[model samples]
Every structure is written in structure tokens, then in C-alpha cells.
Target: MPKILLLFAHPRYEQSRTNHALLRGVGELAEVTFHDLYEAYPEFDIDVAYEKKLLLEHDVIVWHHPFYWYSCPPLLKQWIDVVLEFNWAYGPKGNALADKTCLQVITTGGGSEVYCSAGRNNYSINTFLRPFEQTARLCGMRYLPPYAVTGTHKLTDEELRQHADEYHRILISLRENASVADLKDCEFQDDIPPQLTIS
Candidate 1:
């Protein structure tokens, strides 16, 4: 099974019912390192060497956070600015992260329907995530479609639990069965086949 590194960032975790539910049982998964950025670096000072080490140790990297103001939280942005260095993550001799799979796991306040041409947001979620995709590409990682939970404000307890279960299943599939090819046509990880059959 591929080891997964989940970089979680949330400023107000205690108040977030959706994120709390989504991460209900993720910490217990074997070979999955759930690193809470806010908890680790409350001062917003990221440990570059340690972050790189964690990156090197994982086959799959997941940026799990709430979609804040059409982008990521400040700390996560800070992490990207410092941790993924030019000579180490992108430029010449920066092949350390080559072939790794990377994707975002996000939650949005608006519904999926609202992220379209006719909707209030006037663009898709994928459109808002281009920078993240480019960042992964620059690091020589395979950028997969994001796993998103939209309409967070209206989700009931049962709905949250179901989404949580689906999130768990997706992570398991990514760890044990799914490949880049298997995910190419998917618009979102939620669209992945239930069995996660590798083609």
C-alpha cells in the first residue's frame, strides 16, 4: 500500500462541523500520516527540512483543508511558499517528488451547483484550483481531481457521516488500488467507481 501524507489546515477547527465529520476516522488508518499544520506550526513558522522529509516519505500527498476565500488558508499558503523550494522541489535537481500523486481534499460553503457559469461563483471548483494543480505539476507530481464536499452549511449529521465514509473509502482506494490512469477521466474523486477497479 502506498503511504499517504495528509496535510490538514484549518484555523477554526473546533467550530467546523463539516471538517470534523469528514475526518472522523482518518487518523487510525495505517501508513497514513495525518499532519495538522495549524497544530504543528501555530506560529506560522514551518519547518522546511521536516516538511521535505515528510514529503519524501510518502507516495501520495493530500492537501486537506476548507476552501478559504477561493484559495487555501494563510498557513498552508505559507507552507507552500517555504517548504517547496526552487532547487529542491521544482528547478534542476529537484526530482525528489517525481511521480508522487497529489490532490486537494476540500470543503466549500457553496453547493456544487453554485460553482458554475450561471451561478453566484461564476466558475467551477476546478477553475479555482488551477494554482494548486500547477504547483503539483511543477513538483513533478501527478495531480489528481480533488475530493470535495460542497454545501457544507446544510449537511445533516447523516449526510456528513456518509460523506465521511466516502472519504475514508476514497483514501483506502488511493492507498491500495487506484492509479493515475484509473483516475484520469474523473472530474472529482467522488466520481470514482465504488470498486476502484484498476484498468
Candidate 2:
């Protein structure tokens, strides 16, 4: 199984029922190293060397967070700025992260209907995630579609549990390299075929 590094960033994680349930689903997975950015760097002082080391050790990197104003939280942005350096992650000599996989797991308060061309947001979730996709490309990582749990403000406990179960199954599929093909053409990892994710 490939080692998976899940970089989780949520400033107010304590208050988010969605994130809490998601974590509970996959927190004990043996192949996943769950790194909570907010917990580690409360002062916003990121250790670039340590962060790079973590990246080097993992085959798949997961950027898990809430959709904050169409992007990630401030600390995750800062981590991107400092950890992925010129001579390390992008430029000619920056081949350390080449051939790795990048996945995003996100939650949104808005419903899926509100994220389309004719909706309130006026753009798809994929359109809003272009920057993250480009970042993974620049680092030579294969970026997969995100796994999104939308309509979070009104999701029932049962709905939340189902999403959480699906998340756990998705992680297992990724770890075992069992469903990469199914994930490639999906707009969201949530669209992955149920059969492909059988654990």
C-alpha cells in the first residue's frame, strides 16, 4: 500500500460537524498520516524543512479543508508559499514531488445547485479549484478531482454518516491504487463509481 499524507487545515475545526465526522471515519487508518496544520502551527510559523520531508515520504498527498471563500484557509496558503520552494518543488531541480498524487477533500455550506453557471456562485466548484490543480501540476503531481460534501448546513446525521463512510472507502481505494482510473474523469471524487471503491 502507498503511504498517504493527509494535510488537514481548518482553523475552527472544533466547531465543524462535517469535518469532525470525516475525521472520525478515517483517523485510524493505518496507511494514512493525518497532519493537522492548525494544531501544529498555531503561531503560523511553518517549518519548511519538516514540511518538505513529509511530502517526500508520501506517495499521495491530500489537502483536506473547508471551502473558505473559494479557497483554503490562510495557514494552508502560507504553508504552500513557504514549503514549496523554488529550488525544491517547482523549478528544474525541484523534482522531489514528481509522480506523486494530489487530492482535495472539501466541504461547502452551499448546495451543489448554487455552484453552477446559472446559480448564485456563478461558477462550478472545479472552476474555483483551478489554482490548486495548477499548483499540483507545477509540482509534477497528478491532481485528482476533489471529494466534496456540499449542503453541509442542512445535511442530516444520516447523510453525514454516509459521506463519511464514502470518504473512508475512497482513502482505502487510493491507498491500494484500486480506483485511479475511475477517479480521473470525475468532476468530483464523490462521483466515483460505487463498484470501484469496494474495500
Candidate 3:
């Protein structure tokens, strides 16, 4: 089984029911490591060496958070800026993250319908996620189609359960061999490539 580093970040985790329930389902899986960024460093002072070590240890890295202002929470942006060093995570000498897999698991208050061309958001979630996706590419990591749990504001108990169930299923699928080729089997899933090459 692949080792997964689930980097969770939410400013107001206490108020979260959807993300929390989703987390509860995945927190106990084998080879899954949970790291809450805000809980770890409330002051935003990240330890680079230690964070790099975690990246090295895991085969798959998951960024779990609620979509904030069409992107990630601030701490996540901070983590990427601080933890992924130039010569260590990229550049000629930076190959620490080469071939690793990175996936984004996000929760959104808006329904999926509103994230399309005709939707109020005016773009897909994947569109807003390009920055992250490209960053993963630069680090030589494969960026998988994001696993999204949308419509939190309107999700019924059964709907939330279904989303959580699919979440578990995708995590299991990724722990094995992961490729965008497999994304085709999932129709409603986004249109990310089978393999992404960093330029």
C-alpha cells in the first residue's frame, strides 16, 4: 500500500461538519498520515527540514481543505512557499519530489452546477486549481484530478454519505498505481491529463 500524507488545513475546523465527516472516514486508513497545518503552527512558522522529510517519506501527498475564495486556505499557500525549497524540491539538484503523486481533496459550499461556464462561479473548480496543479508539475509530481466534495451548504445526510463513500473509493484507487488514464472510468470527474510533464 502507498503511504499518504494528508495535509489538512482549515481555519475554522470546529465549524466544519462536511470536511470533518469526510476526514473521519479517511483518518483511520492504513498508511495515511494526517497533518493539520494550523494546529501544528498557529504562528505560521513552518519547519522546512521536517516538512521536507514528510514529503520524502510519503508516496502520495494529499492537500485537504475547504475551497476558500476560489483557491486554498492561506496556510496551504504558506506551506507551499516555505516547504518546497528551490534546490531541494526543484532546480537541477532538487529531485526530492520527483515522480511523487499529489492530489487535492476540496470541499465547497457551492453546488457543482454553479462551477461551469453557465454557473455563477464562471469556471470549474479545476480552473481555479491550475496554480496548484502547475506547482505540482514543477516539483515533478503527478497532479491527479481533484477529489471534490461540493454543495456543502445543501448536502442532505444521504448526499454527504454518498460523497464520503466516493471519497474513500478514490483514495483506495490512488494508493495503487495512479494515472490520469484511470480518470476516464470516472465520468463526472474533471479533465486532467493521464500524465503531466513539468516544463
Residue-wise lDDT of candidate 3 within 1-199, one digit each (tens)?
A: 6788999999999999898778775877777888999899888999888899999999889999999999999999999999999988899999999988888999999989999999999999999999999999899888878888888988998888777777776667677654555544543346675454211
Cα lDDT computed for each candidate against the true fold: 0.86, 0.86, 0.84
Per-residue lDDT tens digits of candidate 1, residues 1-199?
7899999999999898999998887999988899999999999989999999999999889999999999999999999999999889999988888888887999999999999899999988888988998898899887777888999999999988888887887788789857645554433734322432322
Report the Cα lDDT for residue 165, model 3: 76
Off by over 4 Å in 2: 182-199
Q: In candidate 3, which residue ranges exceed 4 Å CA deviation? A: 178-188, 196-199
lDDT of 3 at 130: 95
Using all chains and alpha carbons, the TM-scores for the candidates as numbered come to: 0.91, 0.92, 0.92
Q: Mind giving the per-residue lDDT tens digits that candidate 2 earns over 1-199?
A: 7889999999999898999998894768988999999999999999898999999999999999999999999999999999989879999899888888888889999999999889999988888888998898899887777889998999999999988888887788788886556444433644322332312
Judge candidate 3 against the unseen true structure and give its global Cα lDDT, from 0 to 1: 0.84
lDDT score of residue 155 within candidate 1: 93
Better of 2 and 3 by lDDT: 2
lDDT score, candidate 3, position 55? 93
RMSD of each candidate relative to the true structure: 3.5, 3.7, 2.6
**Clash number for candidate 1:** 0
Task: Kindly give the stretch of ten consecutive residues in candidate 2 with the minimal lDDT sum.
Answer: 190-199
